[model samples]
Target: MYIKPLALLLAVFLASLRLAAQTAPAGHVVVTHLDSKLLHGNPGGENPRRRVSVYLPAGYEASPSQHYPVLYYLHGFTWNDSLIFNQDGMKTLLDQAIAAGQIRPLIVVVPDEQTRFGGSWYTNSATNGPWADFTARELIAFIDKQFRTLAKPGSRGLAGHSMGGGGTVRLALAYPGTWAAVYALSPAFLGPHPSYLPGPGVGPALRATSAAEAQRVHTTLAAVSLARAFSPNPKATPFGANFPGSLGADSLARRDAVLARWVLASPLYTLPIHPAALRQLRAFAFDWGAQDEVKHIPPTCRQFSNLLAVYGIQHTAEEYEGTHGSRIMGSTGRVYQQVLPFFNKHLDFSP
Candidate 1:
């Protein structure tokens, strides 16, 4: 009896070890280096040599002719391609989801979007280069050519968190014909430029002589980064950027002009203009945490969902029980349970 019980315990321990090994694999991520023509000569001087992380599902090597639908996942502000490569338990969750047959096998791509000011926000800026174009055109073209991808809009999906979520919403709306589905998690959605202006010292901080000083003031750096994205002035001194009220003086006229441009870039403002474009999408969904640190995000997400409803555009929006950074790790099951299944249902995985 003792011998039998000991043997059973040994078997269970071995099985657990195997499961752990499968869940976290050091070799899961494949890094590809690309010399981007689109990123060349950016005023911010962000690296043109980029590293893209591609996660291949199990048996990808065995299925030589099976082309998989591609899901392009954008990381949050201050994050790079390494988010998917190492942190966040994304690979482990994906592997578990695939192994469990909860979702079909698909290719996941995470591209580096880090810029001089931390993140590009996945927007096209005179200073930051055309990130939206890079994602919708250049990156897609590169992936289809290199990987065994479905190679069509119906099989492609875009998803992101935080600033990347903002990018997902903007890019998907701007290039409705390019993506089959889109999912945004705790997106940083701005209403207007005037709404972004912070408390005192913001104006002076924007005038910082060095990148270190500018970045030290987080709120000011964020404002400046958005300015670089929306209202870049290549001739501006120091940072070579200008916002609505970067100077100590505030001008309503100048503020309004810049705010108008920002509103135009906003998904809330743009989605209403192109209701038909939104309606044509196969799937559109966004979710935010109830306790998101960005207090405005939950309300913004709700407002955006309502706008879609008003326009008669079909989409899904949800409020989950968590904070902004709560669900990113595989521990939460949001990606496996919600995100992957949404894409599975929408994206065309045939052939």
Candidate 2:
């Protein structure tokens, strides 16, 4: 029998992974599969049982009686809740930071919010389910009950990258009582930027012959994903969301309708509406890469930072030297230097 070359390689690779797991580090990465009631009846019929990645510091088990602060990390579009070994190992990175006293020993939680359309945007909508509610209520309650967490608003922080970064903004504005501090890295679609709307590449996704081509086509699926997240109309076409004539005519009226929905969902548009919520945050910070591949992101980041100033909100925003995904992870990245220090400076770490 002749096996495909890729299949043979995959089998060998998986076996190697199994061998490595046998010698896996003593670092704590709790794998908890949680079934959420909020996502139970999604229009997209996505699985409610989500696997969350939790990182507990070295001393967590030794000091069982002690409670620690929590930081919830949301991953970017098309990316799941993890960074692998070569990506500077999520557990190893934290262990090193704690060992160096760079930051306080704490628990970090990451949820699998990837959906059939690629991402949930960490927002509540009829198409993708109540993602925001699931995080703010169910996930938090479960973590608190199952771990020795400092379970309160003052002790919790929220952060994300790319789409996840935008989620930090959405969650802070909509559910300020859940986390005290928040940060975003290279957030997208800030204040209804039109550059993100779907283009012709989305139309070719259906006919894509190769996986790589399909992946390229899938980038444009953000149109479908964002529509499902923002202006979800269960009775509408295109995955039960009004994707502004995605498969139909791209008319001016249709584009306007879609843009209107985007504004309603944008943090920039909602910033004024939730002045009190933004002010209530113990700390708020976000940054972007000056050389971000996503051309509109750098400017949009500025737009958001400027808007924050206009509203008299106290927050920190900066532009660093890197690309959208370049400076996010590993030891020499924003996660290690900027994000962690920001949280440590703000989040309550008192025993």
Candidate 3:
């Protein structure tokens, strides 16, 4: 199993921003919530619907008629859903950056992607619940329908970090026509590890267990969750590692088979032949920290980058020094800048 390392340089940039946050000017923070009943699965009846935090660029509220390109920002694990509007001084930084000419006037939508575990691999799974569909189909559809968005693939951008980084890639693959650009920040690469642990697959299953046991099970089940989320097999159970429902030696064999499938789907592996898909992509890029403890990222990223080169997929991949947590703010800010500008360059935003 290979884990991608976080970048160290991004951490330094985030640290500097943290210090700057102490004395920042006021009245620049912006937060607005959209009632996502469209994503609630029911149009009527008072049920708890998801709320999306919309961060407008400077002069957005003042210029009501002006429409802006939309950037769908997926949150990594361990984030407060409410903080889609708050937390990490994100709104303030976005406001400041837009004001400072660091980025363009765009609509930023931050949606929570956290589940029972620290994060959702952002793949629709019978085991991991409805996150994949919620994000890929429901969330994106809802945002486009309600908002004054530049509703086109070229005008849309997708991005995330860690678990969300994996999600950004997964979703982009699932819906290649949905986004023109994607930015993965410190993406968690699930190398060629065979997913053997299991629980549920995808579909509704009720196997009640104690909360303590659930947590305990996660030790073995985390890989299963990642697999089920990323590469699902509804026929397999507990769940499928390679094939479905085998044990001991047979399961291991099946697991190896499944790992091959994962390698095929990985950006590092498949981008070489799918030049059309890669070409459809306006921008594809990712960055990691040099101090990142996870060692697999550099090789995996390089492999993916090299494959992109074979297909003539123009992209920017880099490694900077930073850890997992320290680089979120700056990396996020940079991604937003890159993502929006890519859309601006590709899309005819002349409405």
Candidate 4:
């Protein structure tokens, strides 16, 4: 009771610090590598042991009896597992959203699908690794075993951006029972488009030159990624994949075969083959920005949505007023405002 002024101030300061710590977000990220039997071999010579980012809810440690839903997020082309923490700000957004009571507490996991070519295109291949199968089978099983996941389809959600967004739809259809609700944000290459066509200067960029031409180099790398994903050649030299367009007269005779491969890879054309699989999803939603930088994305997304409607599938399709990357940035970002809420509405939180 007879405390001095200095002692009183110190007590107050300690109390404030404790309060701040309590009020701050308590959840954290765990960056680790997973050894996948499915991803064990990469013909392109990229690392086969994949990197993964896992986010545990604030009370994951405190509530041992509680099991939460698992949300599988796929990063876009040229992005690694750590990007959600950096450029996209997704890790921060998830922490804030859970702390603010905007969304349910859930586990979020993203696989580093970025290969030497830029992205794996979320496809299974001898060259790029079976990213598609690894994500659905190996990755999911590993997370459920390592963490307190609900461990069932109804309690699982899948979401992605760019190529990963396309992966969201592709995986949902390819493996219908793996996820309950799925959302695709600015899903790239939903179908065949003019952008997939080989334009001039592409070969030079693929051969690679100066870093000053980063944009071109990245574009070319992405093209090669697509080739590796959609039209791989186990016998080819270097990357063990076929370029979509004519690299030379040797590739010319097989031009239509390569082009058709990509067309069939698109989720737009694959819809008919897997309507029953998609219809099993609890919720299906996709959105694209009107001014997306990918010149063909807007049109392809439109065609994809139209085809879904034509096939009598019940889903959500949105056209927003931003660019591809714009909708997924900042506190007021669409991923926080839209994507998370979509899962919260559809995902089962029981048990």
Q: Could you list the CA RMSD of all candidates, in the order they appear?
A: 4.2, 9.8, 8.9, 7.0
lDDT of 4 by residue, 177-248 (tens): 999999998998888776656533346444544333424466666666777788888677555766655556
- Model 2 backbone overlap count: 0
The worst-scoring run of ten residues by lDDT in candidate 1 lies at 192-201
| lDDT of residue 13 for candidate 4 | 95
Q: How would you encode candidate 3's per-residue C-alpha lDDT over 1-351 as one tens digit per residue? A: 543345566777778777665544333333444454333442111122455677666565676687777777777655644665566666776655554445566777777555444455666454445566677677777777766677777677887776677678767766668787888877766343223222332111213122233344533344444555556655554443233223544332134464565566565554444456656787787877666654555556666667667767788888776776555674355544554455456554546
- Structure candidate 4, residue pairs in collision: none
CA lDDT of 336 in candidate 3? Answer: 43
Candidate 1 wrongly placed segments (more than 4 Å): 1-27, 193-195, 198-201, 249-254
Q: lDDT for model 2, please.
A: 0.80
lDDT of 2 by residue, 264-338 (tens): 788888888898888999889999999998877898889999999998999999999999988777668888888
Q: Over all chains combined, what TM-score does candidate 1 have?
A: 0.88
Candidate 2 matches the true fold with a TM-score of 0.86
Candidate 3: segments with Cα more than 4 A from true spot: 1-49, 129-133, 193-211, 216-221, 231-254, 258-265, 270-273, 330-349
Error of 4 at 108 (Å): 0.5
> Per-model C-alpha lDDT, please?
0.79, 0.80, 0.58, 0.81
Task: List, residue by residue over 1-351, the lDDT tens digit for candidate 1.
Answer: 356888999999989757775764232678897778999988777788888999888778887988999999999877888866677877877877776666788999999987777788888888778888888889999999999999998999999988989999888877878988898888886454234544233465556788888788767677677777877777786676666653535532246576566667788888877777677789888898899877778888888888888888899999988998887557345777788889989999995
